[model samples]
Target: MSKVIEIQDSQFNDEVVKANETVLAYFWAPWCGPCRLVSPSVSWVAENYSDRLKVVKLEVDASPDSVATCKVEGVPALRIFKDGNMISSHEGAIGKQGLQDFVESAV
Candidate 1:
């Protein structure tokens, strides 16, 4: 499977909450500045947690319906899921350290 998976509005229901293990979903958009800044950190955490966590990216601009459901107030919202349930979510850009911590706890 691919290292990074893109989850759109259509796939959100089936891929996210129903996932088998932990999920680090990055709700982002191309026009968002903070989203761009923290993307690499997200990717790094995803790679590091590959065995226990699943990371998916959702482009907010491309998925208005999904964004509405998430009710994201800002860019780069990181939601951690465990046992197919959202355990916690970190809003805004947490950079590398925060991302690593969130993923570590989720997994």
Candidate 2:
């Protein structure tokens, strides 16, 4: 099973922003092709780095509040959060290695 947690706008604050540990928030939409392409890498990160990172996914269409709050203008957006603040973000379909590097850089 995938380790990534599916979150909605209502849960964003409590689940991510208020979390004590580092967070990886993935923003995507059901119709976004690039989102599908990048999903495996996200899942890989969730499984491999579960000890250090809290991985969560928010559907763009379903979670408009979160999308706007994070300034996510595109699908497959990955935002790294620490201490209730966004530390880094990338908008696109980054491959497995690239995703790994991205997460590593933050955590």
Candidate 3:
């Protein structure tokens, strides 16, 4: 099973912003092709770094409030949160290596 938590706008604060540990919030959409391409990397991070990071995915179309709050202009956006704040973000289809580096930079 995947370690990635499928979250919505209502759960964003509790799941990510208020969490005690580091968070990897993935913003995506069902119709976004790049989202699909980057999904594997996200999942890989979730599985491999579960001990240090909390991974959550929010569908852009379904979670408008979170999308707007995060200022996510496009799909496949990855935001790293720590101490109830966003520390880093990348908007695009970053491959597995890039995702690894991104997460490593925060945690």
> Each candidate's TM vs. the true structure?
0.90, 0.98, 0.98
lDDT of each: 0.81, 0.95, 0.94
Q: Which ten residues in a row have the lowest lDDT in candidate 1?
A: 65-74
Q: lDDT tens string, model 1, 1-107?
A: 35778878889878887888788888998898998899888788777788888889998888888677767777888877777667888888886987887777766
For lDDT, the strongest prediction is 2
Q: Give the TM-score of candidate 2.
A: 0.98
Off by over 4 Å in 3: none
Candidate 2, residue 31: Cα displacement in angstroms equals: 0.6
Model 3 pairs in collision:
none
Worst 10 residues of 2 by lDDT: 92-101
Q: Number of clashes in every candidate structure?
A: 0, 0, 0
lDDT of 3 by residue, 1-107 (tens): 99999999899999999999999999998899999999988999999999999999999989999988888988889999999999999998899999999999999
Tell me how far the alpha carbon of residue 66 in candidate 1 is from the true structure, in angstroms, after superposition: 2.3
Model 2 CA deviation exceeding 4 Å by range: none
Which candidate do you rate higher for lDDT, 2 or 3?
2
